[model samples]
Target: MPDFADLRERMIRRQIELRGIADPRILEAFRAVPREAFVSASYAEAAYEDRPLPIEAGQTISQPYIVALMIEAAEIGRGDRVLEVGAGSGYAAAVMSRMADTVIGIERQHNLVQVARERLDRLDFSNVIIIEGDGTRGCPEEAPFDAILAAASGSHVPKPLVDQLAPGGRLVMPIGNPNWVQHLVKVTKAEDGRLQQSDLGEVRFVPLIGEEGWRDG
Candidate 1:
């Protein structure tokens, strides 16, 4: 059997921590969740690598560094409710579940939804829920979320997501052409209702598909 624990430690030290992801909570969450369980059996041996790995529904789980970066950027707290767009394999949601009070994952693919739900359930992450729907629409019924993270790249930040953010909430997502490099942007809703935006860094992700995102080709 592969020494997944050792690989995970090395990944955290080289890929995440050295890259400046210093949040103790985020680091601990990564350590708690087994990335190997999130990927397919075929890819289990490579789970702790720095690169993103393929999952069902043609989706790719975000790299560990990227996931940690987004979570740290959002500044999720124990009392906050987090909504994850493009839940993918539910790995990111599981990580956030450790830090946030509740995590609602919106995934567009039906197969992925089932897989994510099963994984979360089996792992006993009772605070996480995976639902199937158009992620771009945001989870209106569950809003307003304290922190929102979108794993896919959209042309712009969906207005609905911004509207669903609670006062003082933060949203982290990638914005730009999907085929090209995208800017990881963070939007914060100020107490007075104004939106403040900042760029985290460059990243590449699949196109976010839905009414408010890129249209299906």
Candidate 2:
């Protein structure tokens, strides 16, 4: 097995840094979190290989570059509260927790919720919490988040997510049909309650299945 420390640094240098993820804090957080711990033991050696890998459910851990890209786009701060939809194995949530004050990761899969919760707990990520629920609805009880990131792709930004954003907050997610080429988009809510959007780039993601997301999937 490759030394994860060395592989992690290399990943940061090549996959993240070279790709233009410039936030120093997010970069350090990516390097610090043990991504291998978030995946199964079978793929532990390939954890830092710069590609998405399958997890317990029919879900996947997003590639390192995409995770870095979304986090950078969100413009996270040490005091920000972040919401992560489709928490999966909790790798992205763990990374966000390092930069944000609190990160709530929502997933509909009960097994994934348990797995992710355990991983976050074992890693001593006190500020990251994993919840099992319909991610499309967002966590209204913890509404008005400083930043929101969706790990899966929907046809459009879920209304519940936009409604939950704090003033001047950013929400990042992939938008497209489940079987087509999707694009990553950044939606920013103005202080006066308006929403602005920008396209990051094309991306491929699993369908965000839930109320307010893809109905058939």
Candidate 3:
């Protein structure tokens, strides 16, 4: 078996510390989560390598730095309800569950949803809810989330996600043209429903697929 604890320390140093991610809450979540369990058995050894690795459903898990960055950008707090799009492998959602009171994750692939559900269940993370649907639309039934994170990249921010953001809520995602580079964006919605956008940095993510997003061909 691989030394997961040792790998976790290395990941914190190389991916979280060296990358300028200064949020202590985000760091703690990264440290608490076992990333190896979220990846495939074949790639378990490389789970902490600061690189994106293939997961089930033809999707790749985001790099640890990117995950931490996005979570930090969201500025999650204890007792906050969060919505996560593209719940690949359920790893990111699991991390968020630790920081937030509740987490709802949506994935377009049914198989990925199943895998994510099983993974979270096995880990005894009861605070996460995984659904199979078009994440671009967001989860209206559970609207007014305290924070929202999108794991995939889209040409623009989805309107539904913005609508679901609670007052003083934050939404973080990669936005840009698909098949090209994207910018990691952080959006904050005020009580009046106006959104303020900030650019975090450049990032690459799988294209988001949905009616308002890139259509998968």
Candidate 4:
């Protein structure tokens, strides 16, 4: 068996840390989660690699660097309640669970939701709750999230997600066409309920499908 722990540590330092993921808590979170557990059995060996890999139902897990970048952009705190859209294999949710008090992950596909929930539970990341639903709608019942992140891309930030943010919450997502380029954006809601948007960088993500998002094919 590969020394997954050692590989994870190396990935943190080489792929994550050196790439400018400066948050110590995020770094520690990256080290603790077992990436191999979230991937398919056939992809176990590529789990610690710096690149994204296929999961199920034509979905792909985000690369480790992109995950770190998005988390860092959101500026999650230990006491915050975070919401994750497009949970996929639940790897990002597991990592976020370590950096925040609680995390709610939403996925559209039932199969992906089942995979994410099962893997997260088996890994003992009890702080994360996976729900099968439309991610673009956000979780209104759990509204006022301290931080919100989306793993998929659309033409713009969904209005529903912005509405669900706490007064000072931060929302991070990739916005643009999934077939081509997308900008990773961070929107911070001020105390006055106004939004300040920043384009973090360019990224590529699967299409975010929902009512407020791209139409499902």
Candidate 5:
């Protein structure tokens, strides 16, 4: 077994410090979550490294810096309800569970959803609920989320997700084609339901597969 304490220190330094991710809340969440627990046994050693790791169902856990950046961009607050697309191995959902009042994560792959649920349950993260569905549509039953995050990259922002956001809610996602580069965008819904968009930076992510997302034919 690896020394989780030492790995946590390294993650703080390399992933957060060197990347200029300065949010204290993000740092605290990263430290509080045991990333190794969400990764495959083969990739546990690389959990602290600032790199994306492959998980089941051809999905990936985003790099720590990207995770922190997205979470910070959403500006999650205590008592907030968050919606996460692409649950993957449930690492990001687990992190959000620590900071938010409730987290609803949707994944397209059934296998990944099962794995994620098992992992979160093992860690006793009851605030997170994993659903197997098309993430591009968002979770209509759990509408009016305070914040929405997409773990995969899409050619455009799905309108369904925007509709589900509560007033003043923020949605963070990576937009671009799989064969090209993508930009990380933040969308905030105003009280009157108008949406404002801001481009944060460039990012590359796996394609989001769903009704509103790309078809994996």
Candidate 6:
């Protein structure tokens, strides 16, 4: 059996911490969730690697470093409600649940939704709920999220997501073509409803598909 705990520790130290992800809460969250459980048994050995792995529904889990980067960028705090778009394997949501009061993960694929829900439940991550729906349309019923993280890349920041963010909320997502390199962006909604956006860096992600996003290919 692989020493998953040791592998996880090495992944954190080299892939995440060495890259400057210093939030204690974020670090602890990574430690709390078992990444191996999120992927299939065939890919379990690669779970702790610093790369994305294929999950069900033709989707990919975000790399651990990228996940941590987005979570850190959102600045999730205790008692905050977080929304995660493209919750592929529920891994990121599980990690965020450790820090946030509640987390809603939106996955468009039915199988992925089932997989995520099952994994989260089995692991006792009760604070996270995976819903099957279009990720471009943020969950308005549970709007005013303190932090929002979109794992997929879109041509633009969907307006519904911005509209759903609570004043003083932060959103981190990638913007650009899905087939090409994309820019990771952070959008902050000020208390007075003003929005400020800053570029995080370049990244590649699956297309954010839905009504407000790219049409199915």
Off by over 4 Å in 5: none
lDDT of each model, Cα atoms only? 0.95, 0.93, 0.92, 0.93, 0.91, 0.95
TM-scores of all predicted structures: 0.99, 0.98, 0.97, 0.98, 0.97, 0.99
Put the candidates in TM-score order, highest first: 6, 1, 4, 2, 3, 5
Instruction: Give Cα distance to truth, residue 13, candidate 1, Å.
Output: 1.2
State in Å the error of residue 71, model 4. 0.4
The regions of model 2 sitting more than 4 angstroms off are none
TM-score of 2: 0.98
Cα lDDT of model 5 by residue, 95-174, tens digit: 88889999999988899999999999988999999998999999999988999999988889999999999999999999
Q: Candidate 3, residues 1-217: lDDT per residue as tens digits?
A: 8899998988898879888987788878888789999999999999999799999988899999889988888989999999999998999999998899999999999888999899899989999999999999999998889999999999899999998999999999999887788999999999888889999988999999998799888
Q: Which stretches of candidate 1 lie over 4 Å from their true place?
A: none
lDDT of 6: 0.95
* Worst lDDT 10-window in candidate 4: 15-24
lDDT of each residue in 1-217, candidate 2, tens digit only: 6788998899899999998777789889998799989999999999998799999987899999999999999999989999999999999999999899999999999999999999888889999989999999999999889999999999889999999999999999999987998999999999999999999999999999899898743
Say which prediction, candidate 3 or candidate 4, comes out ahead on lDDT.
4
- lDDT at 143, model 2: 82
- Summing lDDT over every window of 10 consecutive residues in candidate 1, give the lowest-scoring window: 21-30
Candidate 1 local lDDT, 88-134, one digit each (tens): 99999999999999999999999999999999999999999898999
User: How far is each candidate from the true structure, as Cα RMSD in Å?
Assistant: 0.7, 0.9, 0.9, 0.7, 1.0, 0.6
User: Model 3: what TM-score?
Assistant: 0.97
**Residue 158: error of model 2 in Å?**
0.9
Q: Please give the lDDT score for candidate 1.
A: 0.95
